[model samples]
Target: MSVDNISRADELVPSRYAVPVGDIEVLVISDGVLPITASTLATTTPPAELAGWLDDQFLPRDVVDWPLNVVVVRTEGRTILVDAGLGVEFPDFPRAGQTVARLEAAGIDPGAVTDVVLTHLHMDHIGGLLTEGLKARLRPDLQVHVASREAEFWEKPDFSHTVMPQPIPDVLRRTATQFLNDYRGQMRTFEAECEVAPGVLVSRTGGHTPGHSIVRLESCGERLTFAGDAVFAPGFDNPQWQNGFEHDPEEAARVRVNLLREVAATGEALVATHLPFPSVCHVATAGDVFRCVPAVWDY
Candidate 1:
Protein backbone atom coordinates (compact mmCIF):
# COMPACT_ATOMS: atom_id res chain seq x y z
CA MET A 1 0.00 0.00 0.00
CA SER A 2 1.33 3.43 -1.01
CA VAL A 3 0.15 6.88 -1.96
CA ASP A 4 -0.87 7.29 -5.60
CA ASN A 5 2.29 7.60 -7.67
CA ILE A 6 0.30 9.14 -10.50
CA SER A 7 1.01 12.56 -11.97
CA ARG A 8 1.21 15.47 -9.55
CA ALA A 9 -1.67 17.63 -10.87
CA ASP A 10 -4.25 15.17 -9.53
CA GLU A 11 -3.76 16.45 -5.98
CA LEU A 12 -6.12 19.44 -6.30
CA VAL A 13 -6.11 20.38 -2.65
CA PRO A 14 -3.03 22.22 -1.48
CA SER A 15 -0.58 20.06 0.44
CA ARG A 16 2.12 22.70 0.83
CA TYR A 17 1.67 25.80 2.97
CA ALA A 18 3.83 28.87 2.36
CA VAL A 19 5.47 31.15 4.91
CA PRO A 20 7.84 34.08 4.60
CA VAL A 21 10.90 34.73 6.75
CA GLY A 22 12.02 38.08 5.40
CA ASP A 23 13.87 37.38 2.15
CA ILE A 24 13.63 33.62 2.43
CA GLU A 25 10.59 31.70 1.17
CA VAL A 26 9.52 28.50 2.88
CA LEU A 27 6.90 25.88 2.12
CA VAL A 28 5.81 23.47 4.82
CA ILE A 29 4.65 20.34 2.99
CA SER A 30 2.62 17.44 4.28
CA ASP A 31 4.07 13.94 4.18
CA GLY A 32 0.70 12.60 5.30
CA VAL A 33 0.24 11.10 8.77
CA LEU A 34 1.60 8.15 10.70
CA PRO A 35 -0.58 6.13 13.07
CA ILE A 36 1.35 5.59 16.28
CA THR A 37 0.41 4.09 19.62
CA ALA A 38 -0.70 6.82 22.03
CA SER A 39 1.58 5.53 24.79
CA THR A 40 4.68 6.06 22.68
CA LEU A 41 4.10 9.82 22.81
CA ALA A 42 4.49 10.04 26.59
CA THR A 43 6.50 7.02 27.56
CA THR A 44 7.09 8.09 31.13
CA THR A 45 3.77 9.70 31.98
CA PRO A 46 1.16 7.83 33.99
CA PRO A 47 -1.48 6.26 31.75
CA ALA A 48 -4.27 8.26 33.36
CA GLU A 49 -2.44 11.55 32.96
CA LEU A 50 -1.58 10.74 29.36
CA ALA A 51 -5.18 9.89 28.62
CA GLY A 52 -6.32 13.09 30.30
CA TRP A 53 -3.92 15.15 28.21
CA LEU A 54 -5.09 13.40 25.05
CA ASP A 55 -8.66 14.13 26.01
CA ASP A 56 -7.79 17.78 26.48
CA GLN A 57 -6.32 17.86 22.99
CA PHE A 58 -9.35 15.92 21.70
CA LEU A 59 -7.10 13.16 20.36
CA PRO A 60 -7.91 9.47 20.46
CA ARG A 61 -7.08 7.35 23.52
CA ASP A 62 -5.28 4.51 21.75
CA VAL A 63 -3.76 5.02 18.30
CA VAL A 64 -2.94 8.60 17.43
CA ASP A 65 -2.65 9.94 13.89
CA TRP A 66 0.64 11.76 14.09
CA PRO A 67 1.25 14.42 11.47
CA LEU A 68 4.42 14.25 9.39
CA ASN A 69 5.79 17.47 7.91
CA VAL A 70 8.79 18.36 5.75
CA VAL A 71 10.02 21.78 4.70
CA VAL A 72 11.44 23.49 1.61
CA VAL A 73 13.37 26.74 1.43
CA ARG A 74 14.39 29.08 -1.34
CA THR A 75 17.21 31.53 -0.69
CA GLU A 76 20.33 32.97 -2.27
CA GLY A 77 19.56 31.31 -5.59
CA ARG A 78 19.48 27.92 -3.79
CA THR A 79 16.62 25.51 -3.31
CA ILE A 80 16.93 23.55 -0.08
CA LEU A 81 14.84 20.68 1.20
CA VAL A 82 14.76 19.99 4.91
CA ASP A 83 13.82 16.36 5.65
CA ALA A 84 12.81 13.78 3.01
CA GLY A 85 9.83 12.37 4.92
CA LEU A 86 8.83 8.69 5.17
CA GLY A 87 9.44 7.24 1.73
CA VAL A 88 6.99 4.92 0.01
CA GLU A 89 8.72 1.61 0.73
CA PHE A 90 7.15 1.04 4.14
CA PRO A 91 3.90 -0.84 3.62
CA ASP A 92 2.69 -0.48 7.18
CA PHE A 93 2.29 3.29 6.81
CA PRO A 94 0.46 3.62 3.51
CA ARG A 95 -0.70 7.19 4.01
CA ALA A 96 2.76 8.67 4.65
CA GLY A 97 5.79 9.00 2.30
CA GLN A 98 4.15 11.59 0.07
CA THR A 99 7.14 13.96 -0.06
CA VAL A 100 8.06 13.34 -3.70
CA ALA A 101 4.61 13.58 -5.20
CA ARG A 102 3.69 16.56 -3.09
CA LEU A 103 6.91 18.26 -4.03
CA GLU A 104 5.91 17.97 -7.63
CA ALA A 105 2.38 19.13 -6.87
CA ALA A 106 3.91 22.21 -5.30
CA GLY A 107 5.66 22.82 -8.66
CA ILE A 108 9.03 21.80 -7.24
CA ASP A 109 11.02 19.46 -9.40
CA PRO A 110 12.98 16.70 -7.70
CA GLY A 111 15.98 17.63 -9.86
CA ALA A 112 15.68 21.30 -9.03
CA VAL A 113 16.72 20.79 -5.40
CA THR A 114 20.28 21.98 -4.85
CA ASP A 115 20.71 20.63 -1.32
CA VAL A 116 19.06 18.49 1.39
CA VAL A 117 19.47 18.97 5.13
CA LEU A 118 18.61 15.96 7.21
CA THR A 119 17.83 16.47 10.91
CA HIS A 120 18.72 12.82 11.46
CA LEU A 121 19.15 9.58 9.58
CA HIS A 122 15.92 8.07 10.90
CA MET A 123 14.09 6.25 8.10
CA ASP A 124 11.18 8.67 8.20
CA HIS A 125 13.61 11.52 7.57
CA ILE A 126 15.79 9.98 4.88
CA GLY A 127 13.70 7.26 3.26
CA GLY A 128 12.27 9.39 0.43
CA LEU A 129 15.70 9.76 -1.10
CA LEU A 130 16.05 5.99 -1.39
CA THR A 131 13.07 5.48 -3.68
CA GLU A 132 13.99 4.93 -7.32
CA GLY A 133 11.40 7.48 -8.42
CA LEU A 134 13.46 10.12 -6.64
CA LYS A 135 16.87 8.55 -7.19
CA ALA A 136 16.36 8.66 -10.93
CA ARG A 137 15.71 12.39 -10.83
CA LEU A 138 18.25 13.89 -8.39
CA ARG A 139 21.05 16.01 -9.79
CA PRO A 140 24.48 14.44 -9.86
CA ASP A 141 25.98 17.11 -7.61
CA LEU A 142 23.19 17.49 -5.08
CA GLN A 143 24.51 18.03 -1.57
CA VAL A 144 23.02 16.12 1.38
CA HIS A 145 24.08 17.73 4.65
CA VAL A 146 23.88 16.00 8.01
CA ALA A 147 25.63 16.15 11.37
CA SER A 148 28.82 14.07 11.49
CA ARG A 149 27.76 12.49 14.74
CA GLU A 150 24.39 11.53 13.23
CA ALA A 151 26.03 9.63 10.41
CA GLU A 152 28.46 7.98 12.81
CA PHE A 153 25.73 6.99 15.27
CA TRP A 154 23.92 4.95 12.62
CA GLU A 155 27.05 2.87 12.07
CA LYS A 156 26.39 1.21 15.42
CA PRO A 157 23.23 2.77 16.79
CA ASP A 158 22.49 2.22 20.45
CA PHE A 159 18.86 1.49 21.18
CA SER A 160 19.44 0.42 24.78
CA HIS A 161 18.34 3.86 25.94
CA THR A 162 15.18 3.81 23.80
CA VAL A 163 11.98 1.79 23.47
CA MET A 164 10.01 1.14 20.24
CA PRO A 165 7.36 -1.27 19.00
CA GLN A 166 8.54 -4.59 17.59
CA PRO A 167 9.98 -4.63 14.04
CA ILE A 168 10.43 -0.84 13.98
CA PRO A 169 14.01 -1.01 15.21
CA ASP A 170 14.95 -3.54 12.56
CA VAL A 171 13.25 -1.54 9.78
CA LEU A 172 15.04 1.62 10.87
CA ARG A 173 18.43 -0.05 10.79
CA ARG A 174 17.86 -1.49 7.33
CA THR A 175 16.57 1.76 5.86
CA ALA A 176 19.41 3.77 7.36
CA THR A 177 22.00 1.32 6.06
CA GLN A 178 20.51 1.48 2.59
CA PHE A 179 20.46 5.29 2.65
CA LEU A 180 24.08 5.63 3.78
CA ASN A 181 25.35 3.10 1.28
CA ASP A 182 23.49 4.72 -1.60
CA TYR A 183 24.23 8.35 -0.89
CA ARG A 184 27.48 8.39 1.07
CA GLY A 185 29.21 9.95 -1.90
CA GLN A 186 26.82 12.89 -2.01
CA MET A 187 26.72 13.50 1.75
CA ARG A 188 28.48 16.41 3.42
CA THR A 189 28.80 15.81 7.16
CA PHE A 190 29.18 18.81 9.48
CA GLU A 191 30.46 18.94 13.04
CA ALA A 192 28.42 21.71 14.75
CA GLU A 193 26.63 23.94 12.29
CA CYS A 194 26.46 24.72 8.60
CA GLU A 195 24.71 27.29 6.46
CA VAL A 196 22.88 25.96 3.45
CA ALA A 197 22.22 29.44 2.16
CA PRO A 198 22.50 33.05 3.29
CA GLY A 199 19.57 32.67 5.68
CA VAL A 200 19.20 28.91 6.27
CA LEU A 201 21.29 27.35 9.07
CA VAL A 202 21.30 23.85 10.55
CA SER A 203 22.82 23.09 13.95
CA ARG A 204 23.29 19.81 15.77
CA THR A 205 21.18 19.28 18.91
CA GLY A 206 21.75 15.81 20.28
CA GLY A 207 18.87 14.07 22.11
CA HIS A 208 16.46 12.29 19.81
CA THR A 209 19.52 10.74 18.23
CA PRO A 210 23.21 11.31 18.92
CA GLY A 211 23.26 13.68 15.93
CA HIS A 212 19.71 14.91 15.88
CA SER A 213 19.76 18.49 14.62
CA ILE A 214 17.42 21.48 14.03
CA VAL A 215 17.26 24.05 11.27
CA ARG A 216 17.08 27.77 11.95
CA LEU A 217 15.97 30.29 9.33
CA GLU A 218 16.91 33.92 9.83
CA SER A 219 16.49 36.76 7.41
CA CYS A 220 16.34 40.44 8.25
CA GLY A 221 14.62 40.36 11.69
CA GLU A 222 12.38 37.29 11.33
CA ARG A 223 13.36 33.85 12.71
CA LEU A 224 11.93 30.33 12.60
CA THR A 225 13.29 27.03 13.89
CA PHE A 226 12.51 23.55 12.64
CA ALA A 227 12.86 21.47 15.85
CA GLY A 228 12.72 18.09 14.13
CA ASP A 229 11.83 15.41 16.67
CA ALA A 230 12.92 17.56 19.58
CA VAL A 231 9.39 18.78 20.31
CA PHE A 232 6.23 16.65 20.07
CA ALA A 233 2.57 17.64 20.59
CA PRO A 234 2.74 16.72 24.29
CA GLY A 235 6.01 18.59 24.65
CA PHE A 236 4.64 22.11 25.29
CA ASP A 237 2.14 21.04 27.96
CA ASN A 238 4.50 18.51 29.53
CA PRO A 239 8.09 19.33 28.65
CA GLN A 240 9.34 16.41 30.72
CA TRP A 241 7.25 13.77 28.97
CA GLN A 242 9.74 11.41 27.32
CA ASN A 243 9.08 10.12 23.85
CA GLY A 244 9.74 6.42 23.41
CA PHE A 245 11.71 6.95 20.19
CA GLU A 246 14.26 9.27 21.75
CA HIS A 247 17.68 7.65 21.88
CA ASP A 248 18.27 9.47 25.17
CA PRO A 249 15.01 10.31 26.91
CA GLU A 250 16.52 12.59 29.56
CA GLU A 251 18.55 14.60 27.09
CA ALA A 252 15.57 14.73 24.72
CA ALA A 253 13.50 16.34 27.47
CA ARG A 254 16.26 18.85 28.15
CA VAL A 255 16.49 19.65 24.45
CA ARG A 256 12.73 20.05 24.15
CA VAL A 257 12.50 22.34 27.19
CA ASN A 258 15.40 24.51 26.10
CA LEU A 259 14.13 24.80 22.53
CA LEU A 260 10.65 25.61 23.75
CA ARG A 261 12.03 28.29 26.08
CA GLU A 262 14.07 29.79 23.28
CA VAL A 263 11.08 30.12 20.94
CA ALA A 264 8.85 31.36 23.74
CA ALA A 265 11.34 34.09 24.56
CA THR A 266 12.32 35.15 21.08
CA GLY A 267 8.79 34.87 19.68
CA GLU A 268 9.96 32.87 16.67
CA ALA A 269 7.88 30.43 14.66
CA LEU A 270 8.55 26.70 15.20
CA VAL A 271 7.82 23.58 13.15
CA ALA A 272 8.56 19.86 13.47
CA THR A 273 8.01 16.47 11.81
CA HIS A 274 5.42 14.95 14.12
CA LEU A 275 3.48 18.06 15.00
CA PRO A 276 0.07 18.78 13.45
CA PHE A 277 -0.20 19.69 9.73
CA PRO A 278 1.90 22.67 8.76
CA SER A 279 2.93 22.74 12.47
CA VAL A 280 3.69 26.43 12.35
CA CYS A 281 3.38 28.18 15.70
CA HIS A 282 4.90 30.35 18.40
CA VAL A 283 5.59 29.18 21.95
CA ALA A 284 4.62 30.96 25.17
CA THR A 285 5.25 30.11 28.81
CA ALA A 286 2.38 28.81 30.92
CA GLY A 287 3.84 28.58 34.39
CA ASP A 288 6.62 25.96 34.52
CA VAL A 289 5.25 24.25 31.41
CA PHE A 290 4.75 25.93 28.00
CA ARG A 291 1.96 26.58 25.52
CA CYS A 292 1.85 26.32 21.74
CA VAL A 293 0.24 29.35 20.19
CA PRO A 294 -0.69 28.43 16.66
CA ALA A 295 0.34 31.19 14.34
CA VAL A 296 -2.47 32.99 12.53
CA TRP A 297 -2.74 31.38 9.11
CA ASP A 298 -1.48 33.71 6.45
CA TYR A 299 -3.83 33.69 3.47
Candidate 2:
Protein backbone atom coordinates (compact mmCIF):
# COMPACT_ATOMS: atom_id res chain seq x y z
CA MET A 1 0.00 0.00 0.00
CA SER A 2 3.07 2.28 -0.05
CA VAL A 3 4.58 4.17 -2.94
CA ASP A 4 8.13 3.45 -4.10
CA ASN A 5 10.57 5.12 -1.72
CA ILE A 6 12.60 7.88 -3.26
CA SER A 7 14.99 10.61 -2.11
CA ARG A 8 12.95 13.05 -0.04
CA ALA A 9 14.62 16.10 -1.51
CA ASP A 10 15.23 14.94 -5.09
CA GLU A 11 11.83 13.39 -5.71
CA LEU A 12 9.54 15.48 -7.87
CA VAL A 13 6.93 17.13 -5.67
CA PRO A 14 3.45 17.21 -7.20
CA SER A 15 2.69 20.71 -8.32
CA ARG A 16 3.91 22.20 -5.04
CA TYR A 17 3.83 25.98 -4.64
CA ALA A 18 5.61 27.58 -1.69
CA VAL A 19 5.91 31.14 -0.42
CA PRO A 20 8.12 32.23 2.44
CA VAL A 21 6.09 34.17 5.01
CA GLY A 22 8.54 35.56 7.52
CA ASP A 23 9.97 32.43 9.16
CA ILE A 24 7.28 30.04 8.02
CA GLU A 25 7.25 28.23 4.68
CA VAL A 26 3.74 27.47 3.48
CA LEU A 27 3.93 24.61 0.98
CA VAL A 28 0.74 23.72 -0.86
CA ILE A 29 0.74 19.96 -1.70
CA SER A 30 -1.57 18.20 -4.12
CA ASP A 31 -2.85 14.78 -3.09
CA GLY A 32 -4.63 14.02 -6.41
CA VAL A 33 -7.85 14.62 -8.29
CA LEU A 34 -11.53 14.30 -7.43
CA PRO A 35 -14.04 13.83 -10.24
CA ILE A 36 -17.60 15.00 -9.70
CA THR A 37 -20.46 14.18 -12.01
CA ALA A 38 -23.16 16.57 -13.18
CA SER A 39 -25.61 14.98 -10.79
CA THR A 40 -23.23 15.68 -7.93
CA LEU A 41 -23.17 19.39 -8.72
CA ALA A 42 -26.94 19.40 -9.03
CA THR A 43 -27.26 18.20 -5.46
CA THR A 44 -26.32 21.73 -4.48
CA THR A 45 -27.04 23.76 -7.58
CA PRO A 46 -29.52 22.89 -10.27
CA PRO A 47 -27.80 21.15 -13.21
CA ALA A 48 -29.18 23.58 -15.77
CA GLU A 49 -28.08 26.57 -13.68
CA LEU A 50 -24.64 25.10 -13.08
CA ALA A 51 -24.28 24.39 -16.79
CA GLY A 52 -25.28 27.91 -17.62
CA TRP A 53 -22.70 29.26 -15.18
CA LEU A 54 -20.07 26.99 -16.71
CA ASP A 55 -21.06 28.12 -20.16
CA ASP A 56 -20.53 31.73 -19.14
CA GLN A 57 -17.05 30.78 -17.94
CA PHE A 58 -16.38 28.98 -21.23
CA LEU A 59 -15.77 25.70 -19.37
CA PRO A 60 -16.66 22.31 -20.76
CA ARG A 61 -19.95 20.49 -20.22
CA ASP A 62 -18.20 17.38 -18.96
CA VAL A 63 -17.15 16.38 -15.45
CA VAL A 64 -15.38 18.68 -13.03
CA ASP A 65 -11.97 17.75 -11.69
CA TRP A 66 -11.26 19.11 -8.23
CA PRO A 67 -7.65 18.53 -7.18
CA LEU A 68 -7.08 17.76 -3.50
CA ASN A 69 -4.68 20.14 -1.79
CA VAL A 70 -3.08 19.86 1.68
CA VAL A 71 -1.26 22.82 3.17
CA VAL A 72 2.02 22.16 5.01
CA VAL A 73 3.17 24.84 7.42
CA ARG A 74 6.82 24.51 8.36
CA THR A 75 7.76 26.64 11.34
CA GLU A 76 10.75 26.62 13.66
CA GLY A 77 9.02 24.70 16.44
CA ARG A 78 6.71 22.29 14.68
CA THR A 79 5.64 20.84 11.34
CA ILE A 80 1.89 21.38 11.08
CA LEU A 81 0.03 19.30 8.48
CA VAL A 82 -3.34 20.91 7.75
CA ASP A 83 -5.84 18.22 6.78
CA ALA A 84 -4.71 14.71 5.67
CA GLY A 85 -5.82 13.64 2.19
CA LEU A 86 -8.44 11.00 1.39
CA GLY A 87 -6.96 7.73 2.73
CA VAL A 88 -6.29 4.38 1.09
CA GLU A 89 -9.81 3.03 1.50
CA PHE A 90 -11.15 4.01 -1.92
CA PRO A 91 -9.15 1.71 -4.18
CA ASP A 92 -10.85 3.14 -7.24
CA PHE A 93 -9.86 6.71 -6.40
CA PRO A 94 -6.76 7.88 -8.27
CA ARG A 95 -5.40 9.97 -5.38
CA ALA A 96 -7.10 8.32 -2.45
CA GLY A 97 -3.95 7.43 -0.50
CA GLN A 98 -0.99 9.43 -1.75
CA THR A 99 -0.81 12.26 0.84
CA VAL A 100 1.57 10.42 3.14
CA ALA A 101 3.93 9.42 0.38
CA ARG A 102 4.00 12.93 -1.05
CA LEU A 103 4.85 14.44 2.30
CA GLU A 104 7.56 11.87 2.90
CA ALA A 105 8.96 12.54 -0.55
CA ALA A 106 9.19 16.19 0.39
CA GLY A 107 11.58 15.37 3.29
CA ILE A 108 8.84 15.25 5.93
CA ASP A 109 9.08 12.19 8.13
CA PRO A 110 5.65 11.05 9.21
CA GLY A 111 7.00 10.97 12.76
CA ALA A 112 7.83 14.65 12.62
CA VAL A 113 4.23 15.68 12.07
CA THR A 114 3.29 17.52 15.27
CA ASP A 115 -0.33 18.15 14.47
CA VAL A 116 -3.01 16.86 12.04
CA VAL A 117 -5.66 19.57 11.73
CA LEU A 118 -9.05 18.30 10.66
CA THR A 119 -11.14 20.91 8.90
CA HIS A 120 -14.07 18.53 9.17
CA LEU A 121 -14.67 14.80 9.46
CA HIS A 122 -15.50 14.34 5.79
CA MET A 123 -13.81 11.19 4.46
CA ASP A 124 -11.72 13.09 1.93
CA HIS A 125 -10.30 15.38 4.63
CA ILE A 126 -9.64 12.86 7.39
CA GLY A 127 -9.34 9.35 5.92
CA GLY A 128 -5.56 9.71 5.79
CA LEU A 129 -5.32 9.55 9.59
CA LEU A 130 -5.21 5.75 9.70
CA THR A 131 -2.85 3.23 8.21
CA GLU A 132 -4.03 0.25 6.16
CA GLY A 133 -4.38 -1.59 9.49
CA LEU A 134 -6.61 1.27 10.65
CA LYS A 135 -3.95 2.37 13.10
CA ALA A 136 -3.00 6.03 13.52
CA ARG A 137 -0.12 6.90 11.18
CA LEU A 138 1.02 10.47 11.67
CA ARG A 139 3.51 10.43 14.58
CA PRO A 140 2.12 8.26 17.38
CA ASP A 141 2.83 11.26 19.57
CA LEU A 142 1.12 13.78 17.34
CA GLN A 143 -2.14 15.36 18.41
CA VAL A 144 -5.24 15.46 16.17
CA HIS A 145 -7.01 18.82 16.40
CA VAL A 146 -10.59 19.30 15.26
CA ALA A 147 -13.45 21.65 15.86
CA SER A 148 -15.69 20.71 18.77
CA ARG A 149 -18.69 20.82 16.48
CA GLU A 150 -17.01 18.50 14.00
CA ALA A 151 -16.46 15.87 16.71
CA GLU A 152 -20.05 16.05 17.95
CA PHE A 153 -21.57 15.84 14.47
CA TRP A 154 -19.53 12.79 13.44
CA GLU A 155 -20.35 11.05 16.70
CA LYS A 156 -24.07 11.28 16.08
CA PRO A 157 -25.76 8.23 14.57
CA ASP A 158 -27.89 10.48 12.36
CA PHE A 159 -24.95 12.44 11.02
CA SER A 160 -26.06 11.64 7.49
CA HIS A 161 -28.91 14.13 7.69
CA THR A 162 -26.34 16.88 7.44
CA VAL A 163 -24.22 15.56 4.59
CA MET A 164 -24.96 15.08 0.91
CA PRO A 165 -24.18 12.13 -1.39
CA GLN A 166 -25.95 9.87 1.15
CA PRO A 167 -23.05 7.39 0.90
CA ILE A 168 -20.80 9.88 2.76
CA PRO A 169 -22.87 9.74 5.94
CA ASP A 170 -22.22 5.99 6.23
CA VAL A 171 -18.53 6.50 5.67
CA LEU A 172 -18.42 9.05 8.50
CA ARG A 173 -20.30 6.71 10.85
CA ARG A 174 -17.82 3.86 10.26
CA THR A 175 -14.78 6.11 10.38
CA ALA A 176 -15.99 7.65 13.64
CA THR A 177 -15.79 4.31 15.40
CA GLN A 178 -12.27 3.68 14.12
CA PHE A 179 -11.11 7.18 15.00
CA LEU A 180 -12.44 6.96 18.56
CA ASN A 181 -10.80 3.59 19.15
CA ASP A 182 -7.42 4.56 17.71
CA TYR A 183 -7.17 8.29 18.40
CA ARG A 184 -8.56 8.29 21.94
CA GLY A 185 -6.58 10.69 24.06
CA GLN A 186 -4.78 12.13 21.07
CA MET A 187 -7.86 13.95 19.78
CA ARG A 188 -8.55 17.47 20.99
CA THR A 189 -11.06 20.20 20.20
CA PHE A 190 -10.69 23.94 19.85
CA GLU A 191 -13.00 26.91 20.24
CA ALA A 192 -13.61 29.41 17.41
CA GLU A 193 -10.79 31.56 16.04
CA CYS A 194 -8.08 30.07 18.22
CA GLU A 195 -4.44 30.41 17.34
CA VAL A 196 -3.05 26.88 17.15
CA ALA A 197 0.43 27.79 16.04
CA PRO A 198 2.56 30.82 15.43
CA GLY A 199 1.01 32.63 12.48
CA VAL A 200 -1.71 29.97 12.20
CA LEU A 201 -5.30 30.50 13.41
CA VAL A 202 -8.39 28.36 12.96
CA SER A 203 -11.58 30.13 11.90
CA ARG A 204 -15.07 28.75 11.58
CA THR A 205 -16.23 28.34 7.98
CA GLY A 206 -19.31 26.20 8.47
CA GLY A 207 -21.99 25.48 5.80
CA HIS A 208 -19.64 23.15 3.93
CA THR A 209 -19.74 20.89 7.00
CA PRO A 210 -20.65 21.72 10.53
CA GLY A 211 -17.46 22.33 12.50
CA HIS A 212 -15.63 22.83 9.22
CA SER A 213 -12.90 25.40 9.85
CA ILE A 214 -10.25 27.19 7.78
CA VAL A 215 -6.72 27.98 8.90
CA ARG A 216 -5.20 31.43 8.52
CA LEU A 217 -1.45 32.00 8.52
CA GLU A 218 0.21 35.36 8.94
CA SER A 219 3.87 36.25 9.42
CA CYS A 220 5.88 39.40 8.97
CA GLY A 221 3.74 41.21 6.42
CA GLU A 222 2.62 38.12 4.48
CA ARG A 223 -0.72 36.39 5.05
CA LEU A 224 -2.12 33.14 3.65
CA THR A 225 -5.39 31.40 4.42
CA PHE A 226 -6.17 27.72 3.82
CA ALA A 227 -9.91 28.18 2.96
CA GLY A 228 -10.66 24.43 3.19
CA ASP A 229 -13.98 23.81 1.35
CA ALA A 230 -15.47 27.22 2.06
CA VAL A 231 -15.41 28.23 -1.57
CA PHE A 232 -15.74 25.26 -3.91
CA ALA A 233 -13.86 26.22 -7.03
CA PRO A 234 -13.80 29.82 -8.30
CA GLY A 235 -17.33 29.23 -9.53
CA PHE A 236 -18.55 29.94 -6.02
CA ASP A 237 -18.84 33.66 -6.66
CA ASN A 238 -21.40 32.97 -9.34
CA PRO A 239 -24.25 33.96 -7.09
CA GLN A 240 -26.10 31.86 -9.63
CA TRP A 241 -24.18 28.71 -8.70
CA GLN A 242 -24.16 26.55 -5.58
CA ASN A 243 -21.37 24.22 -4.50
CA GLY A 244 -21.81 20.55 -5.39
CA PHE A 245 -21.18 19.18 -1.89
CA GLU A 246 -22.12 21.95 0.47
CA HIS A 247 -24.13 20.93 3.53
CA ASP A 248 -26.25 24.09 3.33
CA PRO A 249 -26.17 25.52 -0.13
CA GLU A 250 -27.67 28.92 0.71
CA GLU A 251 -25.52 29.48 3.77
CA ALA A 252 -22.42 28.18 2.06
CA ALA A 253 -22.98 30.60 -0.79
CA ARG A 254 -23.41 33.52 1.60
CA VAL A 255 -20.28 32.68 3.58
CA ARG A 256 -18.27 32.32 0.40
CA VAL A 257 -19.35 35.75 -0.80
CA ASN A 258 -18.32 37.33 2.48
CA LEU A 259 -15.03 35.43 2.57
CA LEU A 260 -14.23 36.32 -1.00
CA ARG A 261 -14.70 39.95 -0.19
CA GLU A 262 -12.56 39.70 2.95
CA VAL A 263 -9.68 37.92 1.27
CA ALA A 264 -9.84 40.02 -1.86
CA ALA A 265 -9.65 43.15 0.22
CA THR A 266 -6.83 41.80 2.39
CA GLY A 267 -4.72 40.94 -0.64
CA GLU A 268 -3.26 37.76 0.86
CA ALA A 269 -2.29 34.58 -0.94
CA LEU A 270 -4.81 31.77 -0.37
CA VAL A 271 -5.08 28.01 -0.94
CA ALA A 272 -7.94 25.52 -1.01
CA THR A 273 -7.92 21.75 -0.50
CA HIS A 274 -10.06 21.05 -3.58
CA LEU A 275 -8.78 23.62 -6.05
CA PRO A 276 -6.77 22.59 -9.11
CA PHE A 277 -3.18 21.34 -8.56
CA PRO A 278 -0.72 23.76 -6.97
CA SER A 279 -3.84 25.62 -5.94
CA VAL A 280 -2.26 28.64 -4.35
CA CYS A 281 -3.89 31.74 -5.76
CA HIS A 282 -4.64 35.38 -5.08
CA VAL A 283 -8.29 36.33 -4.86
CA ALA A 284 -9.77 39.25 -6.77
CA THR A 285 -13.28 40.56 -7.35
CA ALA A 286 -14.66 41.05 -10.84
CA GLY A 287 -18.05 42.73 -11.09
CA ASP A 288 -20.16 40.50 -8.86
CA VAL A 289 -18.18 37.32 -9.49
CA PHE A 290 -14.73 36.46 -8.15
CA ARG A 291 -11.67 35.36 -10.10
CA CYS A 292 -8.64 33.37 -9.00
CA VAL A 293 -5.26 34.40 -10.34
CA PRO A 294 -2.98 31.44 -9.65
CA ALA A 295 0.12 32.44 -7.80
CA VAL A 296 3.18 31.99 -10.01
CA TRP A 297 5.75 29.80 -8.31
CA ASP A 298 8.42 27.44 -9.70
CA TYR A 299 7.79 23.78 -9.00
Best by TM-score: 1
* Candidate 2 global Cα RMSD: 2.9
Please list all clashing residue pairs in model 1, or write none if there are none.
none
Compared with the true structure, model 2 gives a TM-score of 0.88
Please, what are the lDDT tens digits per residue for candidate 2 over residues 106-134?
77777788887888777788777764633
Window of ten residues with lowest summed lDDT in model 2: 2-11
Candidate 2 regions with alpha-carbon error over 4 angstroms: 2-13, 42-44, 55-62, 133-137, 157-163
Tens-place lDDT digits, model 1, residues 1-299 = 23344454677666789999999999999988889899998888899999999999999999999888999999988999999999888878988888988988888998999999999998899988986657868999999999999999999888997778988898899989999999999999999999888878999999999999999999999999999999999999899999989999999999999999999999999999988888999999999999898988889
Residue 204, candidate 1: C-alpha displacement in angstroms: 0.4
In model 2, state the lDDT of residue 37: 63
lDDT measured at residue 237 in model 1 versus the true structure, 0 to 100: 88
Residue 272, model 1, lDDT: 92
